[model samples]
Target: MDRKEMECRLHERFSWLDSLDEQNSVLGLVFCKSGWYNLICEMLTEIEQVYNSKNLQLKSIDLYEIKEKYGTMQTDVGNCIPEVYEIVERYEAKSEGVCEVCGAEGSLHDIDEWLMVRCEKCFHERKRRFYKRGLIT
Candidate 1:
């Protein structure tokens, strides 16, 4: 199939992902475009990576063949991908009191203790600005 056709098929494959229940079970019949089964699997694998990291499972319906046999009902697809839960997990893993400016972790290097505990990037920028103004030797 052509690129547009392939994209449409992929879109249809993912479209069915939305109507699934919270438990990941299919709430209704799933469907997709013809000759794009592998593409659908690839997309599912990508989604699995992000979801698996957060210990969450994504429910998917294998409707590639079904769509080929039955055909797609709608032409336009919708935006309904599930939220990436791994980001929250990653954020929670960060050290407490970490400096948002410089990524420095620990209360000892906090702004109150050192005037400012900027991250390495921010520190360099500040120094560059200070030298430009002849404020520091």
Candidate 2:
């Protein structure tokens, strides 16, 4: 999904995202896909709620592929917290079998020899959209 759709979903789930922005707790938050963004925020929200850390801040949350076989989530909370990495690992494991482009049951597919776990339906949808936008030739 696009920015508006992502923001709409985020706002629906956790209204604090906007407030966090105003409080300067969220920085450099951009370009994250909708599902991944939700997963990351869900983790952080749990941390914030459990620790009750009023001073909590997020430095960054980045997702990238590793060797075309796995995906990684790099998150930096302002302060050290226990079990946070473990929680991140759980989410990573969950993402592995899921489509990166859409939250569907998907395994890796080779597109131009690049591996991506996207369902056949979304694969076609994304391909069509890209072609229509002249992003593909």
Per-candidate clashes, comma-separated: 1, 0
Query: Which stretches in model 1 have alpha-carbon errors above 4 Å?
Result: 1-30, 59-137
lDDT (Cα, tens digit) per residue for candidate 2, span 1-137: 76456555555565444423554444333344544665656765765565455454433322222112334334433334555566656766665566666667766565545556677887787778777888778
Report per-prediction Cα RMSD to one decimal. 17.8, 6.3
TM-score of 1: 0.25
- Candidate 1, residue 81: Cα displacement in angstroms equals 7.0
Query: Candidate 1's residue-wise lDDT over 46-83, tens digit each?
Result: 55566567765455323222222211112122232344
Regions more than 4 Å wrong, model 2: 4-27, 53-78, 124-137
TM-score of each: 0.25, 0.53
lDDT of each: 0.40, 0.53
Clashing pairs in 1: 102-119
